[model samples]
Target: MNAWIGTLIALCALALSAATAYVQHRARKRETLGADVTAYFHRTSDFARIKLFDGTVRQAGYHLVIWNHGPAPAERVHLAVADVEGAAVELADCPPDEFPLQRLDKGARYPVPWIPVSDTHRGARRFTVHLRWQDGNGTQERLLPMRRGQTNV
Candidate 1:
């Protein structure tokens, strides 16, 4: 093979390797986190307190629950929450590494609350909550309607 051609091939190989690594890293990162919940059961807290804003700035705050239904312990759990209606709503990003919800103790429930800080929470009709956990195991999510009225929270 020509010297120049060999060099070109080597460069292409390097680029391919880099791309592969990046893809793998992202896949692993996603796996460590279980799934995203943008449906039901988001307004209620473990204590049965519901956190919601009455179209005011305070409404930007939201409370959610995280339950561990798996038998094995999860290492790190990250939750990304967003308001469905509010464009660019800021969701809480949590990396619970070395602090997975082991306390749930198999089929136990854990409630977590998050506040929207950015303008992305304006006029939000629905919300999307993403839960990422460690080693990519024990990842699940739930999506619930936004409830108004007297919430326990």
Candidate 2:
């Protein structure tokens, strides 16, 4: 009887250990199946002025960049700039406000055209970039704060 009781207890412990390990394995698998996307400012360039019969001046702005640093691809990706009460930041040559990206592969870089901030808004030093996407797990959203001359991911 003593030997039988010892064997039963050992079996229960083994079963509990196996259950715990399985749960941990599932958590790691779910984590690995998701994609990670990031955003940044690539660089700034000046717009060349055209010299025609009449001189015209054109100003240039900086480019905003989005990158996917993922183990999996991000699907149906969307990007937007968060609205502030009195900010004078504007996007130029940008994608539609609610456009979808079919897929963003891992390690891929996408540079948006330009985001020009009006010189009159000197207090607007930082803005938020709202990112949304779908992965294997589900839909996700991230609010990234971007500073001038700095990269935010």
Candidate 3:
């Protein structure tokens, strides 16, 4: 009887430990995805074309993929050009009709168009965009440095 009681006690302790570990794992996953966001610069896959009527002023086209990989959704997401350098790009290009997204659910992807005012597009493409959004905490902002291909946008 004593041995059986000891075995039962050990099993109960093991079960409790497993339950605690499972709960902790779930919490860790939730913490990891608190509110993360990223953007990727899509170069040519978009097949965006631009033809300029004026010889002096030219343009090139590209797109960006903004993604929210967080567990919670981001609201009122807005993107705007912050700065441009080493490139002859348009500074006041109007944003897409979807200026401020109503809501970007978790793990959602959004695409935005980019048309630079340069045809050759030589030299470095150092442009920065400011991103703003609202989440559980409050308003959040990020600066996205543009690059050529699938770089860290």
Candidate 4:
């Protein structure tokens, strides 16, 4: 084979190896993230009438739940809340992993306050909940719609 042709083949092989490594790295990261994350709820309380407390901006404040679904306990399960459009807002963070439900089973539920900072969203015709989190491997996000409340007025 010509020297130039041999060198070209070697360069192509190197490029392929680099690409494969990068892809593997990304997959590993995702797996790690999925392991640590738990399930989150759009609303904490069940579909029952309850008094709404004053929240930060104008919407009624209620406690939302984030359940740990991992087989083993997870610490520092990073969390973030956002609007339907993916705009993030400040939320209370708990370093200590607390499982409201007993045993922290796969489907167990935990309470986390997800106060809608925007009052206008209170009577919102429709809204969504965006959950962002990461455990150790990588990061994952969950989007769920906030259940609408009935209005007498």
TM-score of each: 0.38, 0.72, 0.56, 0.40
Which candidate gets the maximum TM-score versus the true structure? 2
Q: Which ten residues in a row have the lowest lDDT in candidate 4?
A: 93-102
The parts of candidate 4 lying over 4 Å away from their true place are 1-36, 39-61, 90-109, 125-153
lDDT of each: 0.49, 0.69, 0.66, 0.50
Error of 4 at 33 (Å): 11
Better of 3 and 4 by lDDT: 3
Worst 10 residues of 2 by lDDT: 48-57
- Ranking of candidates on TM-score, top first: 2, 3, 4, 1
Better of 3 and 4 by TM-score: 3
Stretches of model 2 off by over 4 angstroms after superposition = 1-5, 44-61, 83-90, 117-123, 150-153
Once model 4 is optimally superposed onto the true structure by TM-score, how far is the C-alpha of residue 58 displaced, in angstroms? 10
For candidate 4, report its TM-score: 0.40
> What pairs collide in candidate 4?
32-137, 33-138, 64-112
Candidates 1 and 2 compared: the better one by lDDT is 2
* Cα RMSD, each candidate: 11.5, 5.6, 7.1, 8.1
lDDT of 3 by residue, 82-139 (tens): 3365332442234356568888899998866565444444333567767788877678
Model 3, residue pairs in steric clash: none
How much is 116 displaced in model 3, in angstroms?
A: 3.0
TM-score for model 2? 0.72
Return whichever of 1 and 3 wins on lDDT.
3
